[model samples]
Target: MKSSGSSFYDRIYRLVGMIPPGRVATYGQIARLAGRCSPRNVGYAMSSVPPDSPVPWHRVINSRGRISVRSDGEPCDAQRQMLRSEGIEFGPGGTVDLSVFGWRGPAGEVSNDEQW
Candidate 1:
């Protein structure tokens, strides 16, 4: 049987992969879409992603729209650079305006009442 952790991570990867280039999603947003998982869990899965994985792990940020600081002292400069290369402009305060660049998940996946 597949481990629940692996299955959960797979689901997170699939969801993250759907975030189109130039758009971003918050960890909380993904957690809501991926029911039964917490935002922290999503972060954990993201941190565990393989260096060569195609999952757009750089597109996810905190609810405040900032790249989360890595606890390992690994700078988030690379993540910021990747997002910038994708045409995602960050504000002076370093937060992406969700209203302008957030992906609302797959069509019909989110409704007015469920908007993040």
Candidate 2:
């Protein structure tokens, strides 16, 4: 059988796959959807995703509505460009407008009033 870590990573991938173009989900949101993983675990799993993986890993952002930078310097900036290409607009602070673009996955819609 696969290790539990593998299982958790697979679940995170599946959840991340559901995020459509122009929309995003946060580290905490993906963690809750993946059952046993925490937000930090989600980040770890994401970091391990291969560059060529079919998963749209770029759609995952922080709860503050900003992209999580890679281990490299701030110049590893493709995530923001990808989101913008899909018409997801960022505001004055370089934060995506999560209320307008957050993808809540299949369970239901996340209310626009959510503090995030």
Candidate 3:
């Protein structure tokens, strides 16, 4: 599906919202949840998140559980801080350990409401 407007973006946002605190999901995971074919679409949807939006955009990371962007400026630092505050551990190389902190979808069977 083509995510061309606010409704499409809203769907992506709502999916992101389902991600629990301290657990991170990959962009591909979000895309799959949103019924999107490409992970790039998930990134695009996140980039368009409004300033006042409550979606947990920071909880969405790459497949390897790494932040898409390195910690550089205030925003990046803030993102890292937020994750850390959630008890997400980072390796010595500043990479999150996916095996430990990554979310593997919902437990057991997928719920009908969770289906994209």
Candidate 4:
């Protein structure tokens, strides 16, 4: 089935929520999972997360294991703090260790049927 209209963002947010805490996933990975081509779209989806969302938006990062942040705001620091509280380690070079904390989501199933 082809997803379109307003549901696309909702679908992306649901996928983002599926990402467990204390682990991270790249934008490309999320895009692929969402059956989308552009990782930037995944980033865009994340950036549009609603104020009342329960999704773990902080768990998504760039392919290079760096947080994708807005150039001018406190949101960047908030993301870093949230990740740190989750015990996700960051290097002195300002990179997340995806090898250690990368999340592949659920192992055996691929469905929107699961809880968000």
Candidate 5:
């Protein structure tokens, strides 16, 4: 039987996949939308994503609009670079201004022609 954890992660992945390239969603936002999970669960799901997955993992950040440090202690430069390539700018304080770049939700899904 399929584990419920897998199902929850799938829901989280689908939601994260919908986050466009330049915009970002907070872990809290994803959890709230995904339901039956917490921000920490969202973080866990992100960490478990395979390198080959299509989910845009870099587009999820903390509520403070900053990248959460990996448990493995790796630098977040890669995430920063990816976001930069997608036109996301960071302030001098090293946090994206949530007001400007925060994704509203999947309700405003990008058009089919728009490359995520």
Candidate 6:
């Protein structure tokens, strides 16, 4: 059987690959989708993917709709620039408007909240 690490990375990459140029997904969202991984694990996979990866690591943000800075103090300006180039505008506080750009999978809205 394939190792969980390999499978986890593969699954994370697959979902990340689906994020369109101007859209974004959260590490938490990706972790939930990948099932067995955590947000930290998703972050690790994002950082570990090969340089030529088609996963679009720049598109994965935090649940607050802001890009999470790298652990090495590497600023996310390049990622913000890349998103801007794709027509994704950021607010004054550097947060994306999730209501407008969030991709909630095939079913649309991705939440388990009850309609009370």
TM-score of each: 0.81, 0.82, 0.79, 0.81, 0.85, 0.81
**Each model's backbone clash number:** 0, 0, 0, 0, 0, 0
Query: Which 10 residues in a row give candidate 3 its minimum summed lDDT?
Result: 69-78
Tens digit of lDDT per residue, candidate 4, span 61-86?
88888888665643487888899999
Off by over 4 Å in 3: 1-5, 70-75, 106-116
What's the C-alpha lDDT at position 68 in model 4? 82
lDDT values, one for every candidate: 0.83, 0.82, 0.79, 0.80, 0.87, 0.81
Candidates sorted by lDDT, best first: 5, 1, 2, 6, 4, 3
Model 2 TM-score relative to the real fold = 0.82
lDDT of 3 at 111: 66
TM-score of 6: 0.81
Deviating ranges (above 4 Å) for candidate 5: 1-5, 110-116
For 1-116, candidate 1 gives per-residue lDDT tens digits of: 44536677777887888788899999988888788558999999898999887898989998888888888765589888999999999999788988888887766343456332
The best candidate in terms of TM-score: 5
The true-versus-predicted C-alpha distance at residue 95 of model 4, in Å, is 0.6
Candidate 1 collision pairs:
none
Candidate number with greatest lDDT: 5
Clashing pairs in 4: none
- The residue ranges of model 2 lying beyond 4 angstroms of the native Cα positions read 1-5, 108-116
Candidate 5: residue 104 lDDT (0-100): 90
Give the lDDT of residue 65 in candidate 6.
88
